[model samples]
Every structure is written in structure tokens, then in C-alpha cells.
Target chain A: MKQLRHFFDLVARTLFVLSSTPFRMKEFSRQLYFVANGSLPIVLFCVGFAAIVTILEASFHMKLVIQNDSMVPGFAALLILRELGPVVTALLLTSRVGAGFTAEVGLMKTTEQIDALRMLGIDPVQYLVVPRLIATIVGTFLLALLASMTCLLGAMFVTDIHLGYSPAMFLSSMRVFVDFQDLLLAGLKGAVFGAVIPLVSCHFGFLCEEGAEGVGKATTQSVVVSSVSIIVLDFILSYVFSYV
Target chain B: MIEYRGLVKRFGAKTILNGLNLRIEEGEIVFVLGTSGTGKSVLLKNTVGLFRPDAGEIWIQGREVSKLSEHDYLEVRKVCGMVFQHPALFDSMTVYENVAFGLRRFEELSESEIADRVKESLARVHLKGIEDKKPPQISYGMQKRVSLARTVALNPRILLFDEPTTGLDPVTTRAVNHLIFELSRKMKTTSIVVSHDMECALEIADRIVLLDKGSIVTQGTPSEIKKSEIPLVRGFLEEVLA
Candidate 1:
């Protein structure tokens, strides 16, 4: 119960900090650009690869089970949007952006930038943690949405090239099974993953003990927590959405 | 003025501060001098409630801060500003933003007013044109100045400096010492400085207190400290003189 209270207290403080002027829309937009701009090429590349693999695997399994290429497109779309999209996008960010955030904040703590904030009567958690939390949410939402769309496009290309099914059939079949809830669930999961990933990662970063060794510890912890969280939360969200 | 009575701090098996008592008058610039690991920084941390003492009371401007809640401590901490040994400039912020951080937080100044004060603070530190530069791009001396600028920008009534001149060139050390003297006079801000650098301490400290094993060993003016007969004092002087 005490721990639960602390959790709510932390959430309240976090919200208050983010609502402060530093994390206002202008700053949020600036940090979002920093978080997302450099990774567009790599994100697109990874999503493209995941889409191709989903199509190839779907075609192989569908052939074994039903002996038809007509159902393969929808299967690819469902898999990409429902599962592969959020998970793969999360993995990419955990490696790329999450580790970077850990390293940056960890280095700052070790070097005393965090101490400076405390001395200035600014809560390091508020000034540092909140802006970062906001950035992660925004960055992750956009990344996951883009990944889902590109993965769908990649699947279409795969159908045209390898499976010889036209784009129209792929679209119609995808429309039949996928709904607003599925996309909403995927995006919502991404947002949760986004918020959780950086919060966990920065928590490790802020808790760093000393110098270079501490920074390394934070980076390792960030990756581990974020990756494990993505997997566990992915399962839970999938199960809950199944009921919905 | 700040006062600590029967202050005791311990870290697990280690006893850092044991039954210590000390005081500083309203506008005095006092240097708490000690070797490494002698709890110099720990003493500074305790004054502002950064670390809670195991026992005893910390009085800041007649308020017993040892018993203040974290929320109330924040109010007390507003009266004090600290500049760390190493420049702790926020890397995510530009020099201008770093100096303006505190003003933005607790002040109701307009954007243009905030901008003017930030510029004034930077100019006071002689870091005028470098406002747009990141901390990493600057020299260590300049970074220290920027840290000082940030602290002074907050306009605290008390300034806590933890080893303000630990690693700097002689010129930078002199500049920092002069700035300390100037700010203490100009703002009438009480300064609690901790340093092992005898030269820098002697240059800036109106009163010098020496600490050993988490206890005050000796304290006096620079002239008196120079004439002290205590073995620890003589030994320290000998080592630094060598």
C-alpha cells in the first residue's frame, strides 16, 4: 500500500513537472524532432524487413494449411498491425533511442548536471524526467504508427511481387478483419510502451551511482527493462484486447 | 546565518559527522577546508537538507531545518544556491537556458525580462557571446563560470560552493576567488565554501574552518590560520607549501 501511494505520488509529480513550461508544446515539438528525425530511415528499413518476413512466413504457413494465396494478404496485414508492428518498433527504439536517452541522462548525472538542477531549486525529476517522458510518448506514438503503415505497404508490395495478388484484394481482405479497435489498440500499446520505456530507462539513469561504470550500468538497465517490459506488456495488452 | 548543533551523520558502518557544531554569521564568507573524504561535501549537503542528519538540528535564518518536511525544505533551499566542484551545466540546454532555468521556474518575469537578466548574469561572469553554445563545446574554466552564472542568476540569499576551485588554472582560480569576493559583497549573500585548496580558500575566506574526521579542528581568520601552532594545521600547510 505504501509503495502504491508512492507510485501515485510519482505520477502526480511527473504530470506536474511535464506540465511546467519546459515541456510545453514548443519544447515538446523540438524534442520530438530530436527523438524521431534521425531514425526515420532506419525505422523504415526495419519495418520494411519485418513486412517482407511476415508475408513470406504467412504464405508458407497458409500454403501448408489452406492451399490458397487469396487469404495470405489479410493474414500478413493482421500479423503486422496486431503483433509485429508494435513489438518490432519497440525493439528498434529500445536499441536506438532508449539506449541513447539512458546514456545522455546517465552522463549528465555523473557529470553533475543533475546536481546543478537540484541546486537551482529545480527538481531534476521534473526538469529532466518529465520532458523526457513527454518526448518518449510522442516519439513512440509516431514511430509505431509509421511502422504499421509502412509494414502494410511492404506487405502489399510483397503480394504484388512474390505472391502475385493485386493490391485491391489485399486492401479488401485487410478491411474485412482489421477495425478501428485493432489500430487503436496497437497505437495505444505503442504509447504505453513509449511512456514505460523511458520512465524505466531514466529511472535507472537517475539512480546511477558514480562515474563511467554507473553510466554503463544505466544503459544496460534501460535496455533490459525496456525490452522485458515491451514483451510482457505486449502479451497483456494482446490478451486484454482479445476480450475487447 | 546558518548553524548546526549536535549534527551527526552516518553512512551505514561509517560515521561521517559525529557530534559536530558550527555557525556562520549573516554575511560572512566561511570556507570549510578539509582533505578528500573528510566530509566537506557531506557537510554542505547537510546544511541544505540534501542529506538528513542522524541527529541534531540545522538552523537556517532561525528556522530549525532538520525537522522541516521535504516540501518546506524546498522553500529553505530557495534561499541558497550551490555551485558544484565540477561544472554541472545541463547539456540539453544552451548557456542562456541554463542560466535562465531557475528564474523561469519560480519567477513571474516576462520573457523579455528573463532574457535581459540571463544576459546580465552571463555578462557578470564574462560569458557574453557564448550563450548559444553547448556546455561540452566550452573550456572547463568557462563551464565553471557558466555554473556560477547560473547560481547567481537565481539570486539566492545564501550561496553554497562545494570545492569551487578544485581543478583550474591559476588564472581561473583567481577569477573565481575574485567573483566570490565580489558577489559576497554586492549581494550580501552568506557563502559556505568547501575546498581543499589552501591558496584559493585563503584568498576568498573571511573566516576559515578546518575539518578532520567529520569534526571541526580549528577555525580562524586567514592571518590567524597562518599563525596557528596546531600539528594538523602545520602539517597541512607544510604539504601545501611543499
Candidate 2:
């Protein structure tokens, strides 16, 4: 019951911060730079590998069932757009950006900086949480799009070399099966995961105990909780988006 | 002016401030002296509405602080500033940005004007020409001074200090204490410093209020407190002054 109350409180506060505009625009841009720009290499690398693995597995299964490689692109596209792209990107970000947020805010809490903000008549929620939340939401959405594209390119490269299909053939096959709804589901998953990552990370960070050990603990907990949350939320979102 | 009437605060099962009552007059420097865990810091935090009291009334400058909403508390907080023990300068920002933080958030000033104010506040704390330096790059003493500059730039009516001189060498401690004295005298801001440093209390405080176990053990001018015969007060004074 207490956990539920805190969760509701966080949701309410997040909604309030989202509705209020013109809030710390400079901080928002800085966070966007950190979250989106800083995580690009890792996001690309992770999604690319994930795509290769998915394509290998799907192509092997398709060869056994239909005795051909034609279904590789369609199967790979469906997997990437509906599951691998958004989930992998969010999990990577959960480790990178989400843990970073926890450490930063947790350190601030330990060092009395949060109290300093309040003493300066600045609401810490408005100053700290809002910008990060907005940045994560927007950054993760774009990164998910990037992830989908990278995965497709990776699959195409693998199939062109190994499966005896040209890049154009792979592209056309994917385009035939991968519709706008798949892209929308991926984008929606990214948005929800983005929101969940920061909310959990910041909550743990704000509730961090004192000292260096406390910060370490909060950072670890943030990554673990956010990763678990992303996986669970992915399941629920995929179920919900199945009807669409 | 500030007044705490029967302020009560607790952390979990531990009671920190137990119906503590105290009053601080405007433009006067008051030092709250207490050993560790005696709630001196908690008392200062309560005045700034950082920690709300369980059952009490906190009035600052004729306004009741306990009843104020978060928005209303910000209005009250604008008239007050706190320098924490560890300086608490924003780690990501340079000294100039740290000092300018409050001014940017609370005041409407041109960029040049904000720069001027930041420079002037740093100069007031004798920290001129180090605006580009981050908190970790500076000495601990300079960080504390920067913290002071950051708070003083707001031109608050009341200033609160929590263990302001802790962890400093004797020289830096004296310098910080003297800075507190000078700033209070020059700005005529109501200052409440919580410290275990009896020498600092004697040097800078117009009045000393000593707390022991969540209650005021004694409250008087330095000389009066010096003459107090209460065993706990005398023993504490001896231990701190020795």
C-alpha cells in the first residue's frame, strides 16, 4: 500500500511537471545533449548486434520451414520493430542515462545540494526532475527510431553477405511486412520506457541514504529497477499494442 | 526576526527537537551551539522550512512559516539563505554560475547585471576572480566562501549557517568566522549560525543559545553564558573552549 501511494505520488508529480511549461529550458537542452548524444555509440552497437543475432536465428528457422531465405527480412523486421529495437535501446539507456541520473541526483541529495535548491527558493522537482524527464522522453523516442534503423541496416548487411540476397531485396521484403503500426508500437514502447526509467531512477536517487556507499547502492538499484521495469513494461505494452 | 515556538521534530523513532522555543531578533547574529546530534542543525533547517516541525509555530519576519504552502514557503525562503556545512555548491557549475544560480532563478536582471552581482558577491566574500573554477578545483575554505557568496548574492533578509566552520584548519576557521561577522555587520542581515565551535560563537554571536538533548540548556550573551554555573553548560563550555 505504501509503495502504491509513492508510485501514485510520483505519477502525479510527473504529470504536474509535464503540464507546466517554460521550465528550466537550459537544463532541458543540456540533459538532452547528455542523454541522446552521449549514448549514440552504445545504442548503435547494441542494436546492431541484436539485429544480427535475430536475423541469424530467424533465417535458420525460415530455411528449415520453407527451404528458402526470402522470409529473413520480414521475420527480422517484425522482431526488431515489435520487440528487439525498443527494448534493447531502453535497456541500454537504463544502464547509461538512467544510472547516470541516479548517481548525479543521489550525490546532490547526499551533499545537501537539494536542500540548497529549496533554500534558494527553487523547487528541486521543477529544477531537477522536470528537465531530465522531458529529455529522457524525447531522447528515447528518437533513439528508438535510430535503433530500428540501425537494426534494419545490420540485418540487411548480414543477409546480403550470407543469405545470397541483395540489400534492395531485403529492404523491399521488410517494407512489405513492416507497417506503420509496428513503428508506432516501437515508438510508444520507447516513450513508456523513457518515462519509467527516469521516474524509478530519480525516485531511488532522491530517497538515497547518506555517504558514498549510499550513492553506490542507489546507482545499482536504479539500473536494476529500471531494467526490470523496462522488461515488464515491454510485456504489458506489447500485449496492449497487439490489439492495435 | 525569527521565532520558534515549541518546535518539535523527529526522525523515525528519534526525536531531534523536542518542543524547542527560541527567538532571534533582526540584524542580530545568534549562534546556536550544540554537540553532535543535539539538533542545532535541525533547528536552523526548521527556521528555513527545510524540515517542518511536527507541532510548533515558526514565524519569520512577522509571517507564520509552519502554515505556509510550498509556493508560499518559496516566498518566505526568498528572504532567507542557508550555507550548508559542505558548501553544497553545484558541482557541475562554475563559481560564477553557482552564485548566479539563485539570482537567475529569483531575480529579473540583465546578463551583465547578473555578472556584476556575481562578481560583487564573490568580492564581498574575498573570492574575486575565480568565477570559472568549479567547486572541486577550489580549496575547502574557498568553497565555503563561494557558498556564502552564492547565498549573499540573493540579498536575503536572514542567513542561516549549519556547522559553517567544521573541518577547517584553525586559520580557515577564523577566516570563515570573521567573514561571517563582517558580512553580518555590513549587511545587517539576521544571522543564525549552528556550530560546535565555542570560540566562533564567542567571536561572532551577539547572543549564544546552547542546546543539549533537544532543549535549550542556556541562552544569554557570551559573558552571561560564560558565567553560567549549570553543570552541563559549564562542562560543555570547558570542553569546547579548552
Best by DockQ: 2
RMSD of each: 3.2, 2.1
Q: Write model 2 residue lDDT over B46-161, tens digit each, in one string.
A: 88788888889999988888977777888888888899988999998999999999999899999999999999999999887799999999999999999999999999889899
Give the per-prediction TM-score of chain B: 0.96, 0.97
lDDT of 1 at B197: 71
Q: How well is candidate 1 docked (DockQ)?
A: 0.61
| TM-score for all models, in order of appearance | 0.89, 0.94
**Model 1 ranges off by over 4 Å:** A1-12, A15-23, A61-70, B106-132, B227-231
Q: Give per-residue CA lDDT, model 1, range A16-110, as digits (tens).
A: 76666454666566667866776667887998998998889888888888897688888788888888777888788888888887888788777
**Colliding residue pairs in candidate 1:** none
DockQ for every model comes to 0.61, 0.74
**Quality of candidate 1's docking, in CAPRI categories?**
medium
